[model samples]
Target: MYSNTSELAEDKLLLLYLLDKIKLPISNNKVTEIILENNFINYFTLQQYLTELANANFINYIEQEGKHRIIVSNKGLKVLSLFRNRISEVKIKAIDCYLKKQMESIKKEIAISADYTIEGNNYIVNLKAVENNSILIDLKLNVASNKQAKDLCAKWKKNSSKLYNELFKVLINN
Candidate 1:
């Protein structure tokens, strides 16, 4: 219930993910396998985090099949959206705004619906520590070999020609 703990945020994410995986209140084997596959944490370390999670009341259960059979408490799922928004490497809203302007020239895809998230490189911009810079720019832009990304950048930069040339130059060179 307490969200103030440092581990609570990450623990909350794990709880939600695990709960989704074992929707039927599974035993330890199934839960542990899912956690390992997702790379939430290594086996040894997860044990420690699990204790913290129990203390935080995100998830609590007995160990079965040599692993923890976890479930997401209501208090746990409550923090998921907050953690997702806070820890996300890319801010979805900013990317949507930037991509909306840049990709206008390209074929539209669903017009930025609510589910749009920074799940992949195509729609993602590593926004961690990204401050005091143009909205659309990111290090991942360097890996874009496709015309869509290039053209989108060009269109955006072209639109802002008088205000700044740095963005336009990047698009032009690409």
Candidate 2:
């Protein structure tokens, strides 16, 4: 249970602090996961703070190929630099621990993405794989139905690495 004013302040600072440490454009889902895992704040409060931070120009929300990601703005970095110490060291350590454990899963999610859109009678599915700032794969396929598009996306999420490997093998052997 948190009081209104102090709780809001702490929640905002904690969100900023987590973003600063992660140092990457992360999805709202990922941020929610970390906050919930820590159990410091409720989900509703976290969403409120995230909105407030973005509204204040402390963070920017970007949609890339249909994925929503948030990054700290220059203003955010400055604010964090000045006030990050206000957050307790214990909290910082806890965030660090959580990030360390979950980084691989985070990377896995960010590395591959799938999206679909309807064009006339068909669905166009766009599947992508990125590492660092480089695009490793950009594939688009036309499917007959929305269900097919959706199933393709689910399979892509699960079997992207294997698919990529097979693709590379065929390309190289040809």
Candidate with maximal TM-score: 2
Worst 10 residues of 1 by lDDT: 107-116
The residue-by-residue lDDT of candidate 2 on 34-135, one tens digit each, is 899899778987888888899999999998656799998899888888877777778888999998998877877888998899999999999898888688
Note the residue pairs that clash in candidate 2: none
Model 2, poorest ten-residue lDDT window? 1-10
Question: TM-scores of the models, in the given order?
Answer: 0.37, 0.85
Error of 2 at 117 (Å): 3.0
lDDT of 1 by residue, 35-154 (tens): 575555567666666677768887667553233456766666676655655433332333344335534332111111111123446543221111122233233333333455555445
Candidate 2 ranges beyond 4 A from true positions: 1-7, 145-147
Give candidate 1's error at residue 20 in angstroms: 3.6
- Candidate 1: RMSD to truth: 17.4
Q: Give the TM-score of candidate 2.
A: 0.85
